[model samples]
Structures are given as C-alpha cells and as structure tokens.
Target: MNGIEEEDPIVFEISVVVPRRNLKLENEGFDCVEVLVNEFRNVGFFVDRVLGLHDEFIKLAAPLETLGVVAARLHMKKTTHIGVDLPFEWEEIEAFMRQPDGSLFSWCERFQCYRHLIHFFLIEKNSDVTLKFDGIEIQWEPGEALLQRLELEGIVKQVFPLHDETKRNKLLRSWALNWWDLISQPIDEIYVYYGTKIAVYFAFLGMYTRWMIFPAAFGLILHFVDFGSLKLLVFPAFFISIVLWAVLFFQFWKRKNSALSARWHLNFSVGTSHGYKLSGREWNCLQAPVELVKGSGIDKTKEKEDLQRYEWFGYLRRFRNDVIVILSIICLQLPFELDYAHLYEVIESDIMKFGLTAVYLLVIQYFTKIGGVRSLFYAVIYWWVFYHALLHRNLMILRQVLIQRLIFYEKQEKARGRFDWKDTICYQGGEKST
Candidate 1:
C-alpha cells in the first residue's frame, strides 16, 4: 500500500483497457437488467459474489499494470457480481498510469477519492431481498454473525454501475471554473480524455458533412434548379438555408465547447496526451466503423481478414426475418390489390396525395409487424432508388455503399467494444501471458 498527503488536487486518469475484442460479460441475458438483479436476489447472500469479483479484479489488475480498469471491466463482463464503478484502493492497486498528462497515479488516490465516492452506495427495500443505498439487508437464519442480506433478487434484477465521463466532465469543468478552492484537484486528466472524444466526434461530423452529404447534394440541387428555371424545385432557397442553418449551429457549438475546455486548461483538439501515442491495435476503438470494415490483411498464416467480419448466422437470420416479412406483405396485398392499384390516381392528386401516403404508411407498419421486415424495407428502399427521376444510378450506388457500411455497423459492434448482445468477439489471446 502507498500513502500520500491529500493537500493537492486529485487527478484520476481515465483507463483505456477495454475487453480484447469486447467479450460478453454474461453469455445469456435476461429480459432486462432489473430482471437479472431480481434473479440474483432470489439466491441467498449474493453480495459475497460482488466481493469475490472485486478480489478477482484486484488480482487480475496487479499484472496488467495500467489495465486495472480494463481488467475490472472484463471481470464485470464475464460475471454480473460486481462493477468497475467502485474506487480502487491503493493498498490493493499495484500500478496504473494516467495517460492524459503522462502522470503515474497509485497507492494514494484510493483514500483521496473516498470522499468523492461517498454518495456511490444507496439503500432501499424490496419484497424478496431488500438491497438499498445504505447497504444490503435481508432475511436470514437466527445464527448468522451479521445483519447483511445474503441475497438481492425480488424487485431488482441487475445493475450496471458505470461512470459517465460526459456527465463527470460537465460537472468538473463547471465547478473548476466556478470555484477557486477546487483548482488543485485532478479533474484535468479526465476532462481532457472526454474532451478529446467530443472533439473527435465534431471533427468527424464536420468531415462527414463536407464529403458525404454536401458535395453530392449541392451538385444535384444546382443541376435540378438551374438559373433559367430556379422554380423547378419547391423553395430552392429554403433547402439551401436548411443546410446552412445546421452548419451555423454546429460551428457555434464547436467554438463554445472548445472555449469551455480551454478555460479548464484542457486541449479540445487532441485526445489525452497518452491517447495520441497509443498504437493502432490498442486504439482501434477510436477509428471509424467503415474504416475498420474496409481494412483487411490476409497472409499465408491467416486465411481470414485481420479486421472483424460479419457472421453468416446473423445475415441468415436477418434474411429469414426479411423473407417472413415479404411473405406477409404478399398475403396482405392479395386482399388489397385492387384498392392499391386504384390509389395511383390519388397519389397524383395534390390534396389526396397526403391521404394516400398516410394509408400506405399505416399499411406498411401493420405488415411490418407480421414479418419479412428487413427484406421488405430493403425492397421498398430499392424501389425508391430505381424509381427516382434524377440520379437514378447514383441512388443505387449510394444505396449499396450505405448497405455495406451499415451491415458492418450493425454486426461489428462488439469488435469496437460496444454493448451488443447478438454479436461479440472471441478472445484473441488477450489473456494473461505469464
């Protein structure tokens, strides 16, 4: 254990150790987190399980050096006993680094952060086993040594206690600026880490607008509404103004957020000082999903691509669902074929067109409940792409690009350490080596 004077501000550096490939904490999930907690309460003396998880996380963290949080995160992932939201005791923590300022923190922050963690625990009452903020209280045999509840299940199913960086940073920056006494606190590192994330998101958003939406949109708009016939498209200026309106708001916020971070002596443009230096493999979580999907490396030793790929099982499942949906749509259409064909006239009329669209939307929603949803939607999307007057082939190309990128987005979430249930990555030798 380490000791230190608590005079200066405490700088808690955010940990970056996620699961190797986002392995699941629980293999099978219940309907909800509450249900899971209730199940635990049903069993007797489950708080011991949380303690056990804490012990295991400590043991795992000792060897991983800076990966204490990551190790704790992984432990919570495999078992629902405890969470990484708790503070690390210095006597127990071996070694860890705060990457933002390149400062090492250990041995003393445990006690220093205790006051901040004062409100972490809560006590409440329930039917089966009452686990409240004050602590755990439950029914037990008369011979027990303590009054603590052995289980916590009736009303509460589960809990995922996670520290929210956005909220924390928001409060910290506000307080640090407002209070002079809090200047010595270690809020900068955490602020910098989360600040960098916001910065990157905005940076990416700016690029996406510049490249993905604007270029093609303005080019098409100008082509459709030429100088000779500007009235061809309804409210051409209105469309242009809509795009500019969003641009102005985004620019204004970007400046405001940057300025707020600057007041706290944080950099809004870059990731934590250490984050900028991390290797590509360790920091893959920061990259764009499309970039991850497009990159691949296959050699004599490896038959498959190095980056994450989609699973055929998921694709087949979606296909089957889509198939069912299309079949249901067909069955519904059999009864309304005459009515739908006749609605072509209503679609052309200005006033009746809205009613026709509303009816179609209602019908689509009704049939969407029946089956073949993905396929049916895909077909509808393709129909629009093909039927559009301008950019006929361009829409098809955009559709394919979107479809391919979205498929990876939907399935490769676990690879990026997302909380995705259906898809998860198998451990790729991230276990302890020694």
Candidate 2:
C-alpha cells in the first residue's frame, strides 16, 4: 500500500517542516505532530508525512470541495463576461468558474486559501491539551490555534509552497527558452501559473516592445536619408510625430488593458478596492461596518466621531513625517551639495576635478541617496521626494476609503434589513452608480 501510494503523482502544493521526531502512541499522550496531521485531515485536507534525517515534512493538498467552501467563505470575487464581479458561491460553482486552462484556482489564489485555512481557521478544540514535540513540553491552550502555537514555540520551522515539476519544466521550455519568436508569448499559460499581476506586466512589456519598432524605423529614416531643402521642416514634423506617438501609445495601452481584463473575466473596478481581501488574509483586522454597528450597546454617532478623529490623526501623522524629511534634507544635504559645487568650480586640474567629482558622487550616494538640486544630481532628490510623497498620498487615500466605508455602514443601518442591487454592489470603499 505504501509503495502504491508513493507511485502517485506529487499533487500536494504546501509543505510544513519540523525537527525529526518519533510518533507517540495513543496510550501515552497526544503527540503534537499526530494532532496537527489529524487537524488538517479534519479540515478536509489530504495530509502526507515524509521523514528526513534532520526534519519531518508534512505535505498538504486541498480537495476541490475544500477550496470551493473556503472561497465562498472569503467572499472572493470572480470574473464575469459582463466585466462585473460576483461573490463566489460553492453551491453554484459553475457560475464563478476559472479560465479555459481548466485550473480552478491560480497558484497565487490557492496559496492564499491554504494560508488562511492553516493560520486562522484551524483552532484548538480541547482544553489543556498538553503535547510534546521533540522532548519539549508545550501547552495547548483552549481555543488557541495549534499551528500558530507551534510556530510561537519554535517547533515548526517553515511552511512553503512546492512546485509541480512537470508544469515547471514545460513552462521553462515553452516560455523561457523559446527565443525564435520574440513577439509570441505564452500569456494564457503564464496567467494560469503566475496569476494576473505577472501576466499583465508581461503583456504590457510585449506591447511596449512591439510599439517601439515603428519609432525605431522612423528614426533610422530621419538619420540616414537626405532631404536637402525640407530638412528644417522634417525636424519639427519628427518632434510632433514622436509626441503624438507617445500620447497614442498610452491611450491604446488602456484599451489593451481593458480587453485583457474582459477576456480573463476579471472585474477590474470591483477588484481594485477589495484587492486586500484575498481568501480573508488581509483586511481581517477591519470588520464589516454592518457588524460593528450591530454589536450590542454600540453608539453609532460616537463611532463615526471616533473614525473622523482617527482619519485626521492619520493625516497629521503623515504630515509630521513629511515635514521631518524635508527639514532633514534642507539642514543636512543642501550644505554638502553647495560645498561640492564650490570646490568643483575652484579646482583647476582636470584630474583633480575628476577625482573631486567622483568623491562628491560617492558622498551624495551615501548621505542623501537623492543626489542634488538644480543640476545633474537634481533628478535624484526629486525622485526621492516624489516617492515619499506618493507613498503618503496612497496612505491618505486608504484612510479616506476606510472612513467612507464606515459612514456608508451608518447610512445602511437606516435601510432596515433591505437588500437591493445598490446595496449588493457596494463594497468596502463605498460605491456609487455614477
């Protein structure tokens, strides 16, 4: 039976590693490893154990039924031809189906489901269930998670996803090594294997490369070809054409993006706001507004006030951080830059100037990271400041979204248990028809 089992294809994707240990008998006490394996099995996972010289590996595979149930619970959004999102329903599996590759879930999606299940869903059932792991006695508290406890105690080393060797080799040959056709790419296969992000990135890269060909050809014509009297007019025309090409390329890229989203059955607008809720992994800390309002003895007016307070506080905090960054740059970096410029101008020998420039560059790279202002080094400071500004701006946006969601929850409280198209479609960031 063991030999036959070993012959089966390695379908399990997740593996858990722990120090090598012997299995305990039921007569003695509950072995930690055995209990964990049983817990996985109870949760509808196919668990297999392999022993190594230094560690024991616990391999796990989720059945289709388990994946479906988890997906529904997470309220995962799937693609529709109409370019809208619908929450996953296990009872009606055919409605929220995957793409033509016949993969029920992308590698990214499956990993998320597995992670949530193991980390949050698997809870300790019994009280005072003391377990032993490799000669160390551990307390298994009631209602506490076994895996999390094991992790805390340093019993479990690490958990990571394993790749299917067959699919990996095939992808390597078809996509990575096939250089004969530069434009042709296995986009669908890439999407199926790597999920949407990687596929979309490569799609854009390929499209950009293809678009550059026309400009390249045009530039060659302008460079080599001689047009004696028309040369002055040709320069302006070439400049205008280049600008027009860039504008058109960006506009067309959006169209291509939309087309890909529709083809992949992705709900672009809906998924963008709720991107954090992949299989109940992120955004778990923030409960639904409805749930918060429904809690006993809750005061709605006070809650809104608290949310408003938090929102302003977050903005102020970000402002303070930004002010500190600016002050530091002005106080520390500006003087050094000025000194470098003064020295460069005063220095006469070419070799001395070159050496000074090199030293200045190294000093700038080390201290400011952002090079300088109103010179060749000016771009670095601008880029550095822009990055910080953009980061804070995104945080502010997220804060505003959260506050809006809370307000929407308060508004919905007045609707009195009514469910309509408007309510159904509205999500965490709040939605409007227009």
Structural similarity to truth (TM-score) of each candidate: 0.23, 0.59
**What lDDT is obtained when candidate 2 is compared to the true structure?**
0.67
lDDT of 1 by residue, 1-434 (tens): 24432223323322211112122224223222222233333321122222232121100111122233433422211111132233333334433233344323322232222212221222342323322221323443333211122212232222222244554676567654657652233444444434445544554454445544554676687667656644433343444344444445556656766764444433222222332112133334356434433443324223233322324545787999989866655554433333433343324564454444445445544454443344453355334323322333465444543454355444545455664422333233334332
Clashing pairs in 2: 79-265
- Name model 2 segments beyond 4 Å from true: 1-10, 22-29, 79-85, 123-126, 268-434
Q: Please, what are the lDDT tens digits per residue for candidate 2 over residues 1-434? A: 12111123438999999888765555444688788888888888899899999999999998776876898888877754455577777776655556656666677667778987887754446658778865678888877888999999888999988877777788899988988887878888888777899999999999999999988998999999998977755764565456556646877889999988777776534334452232223322345533443553446676676457657867999999978866655544444444544454456675665565556455554443332233423434333333333444566533543344344444545554566545666753364534
Each candidate: what lDDT? 0.37, 0.67
Which number leads on lDDT?
A: 2
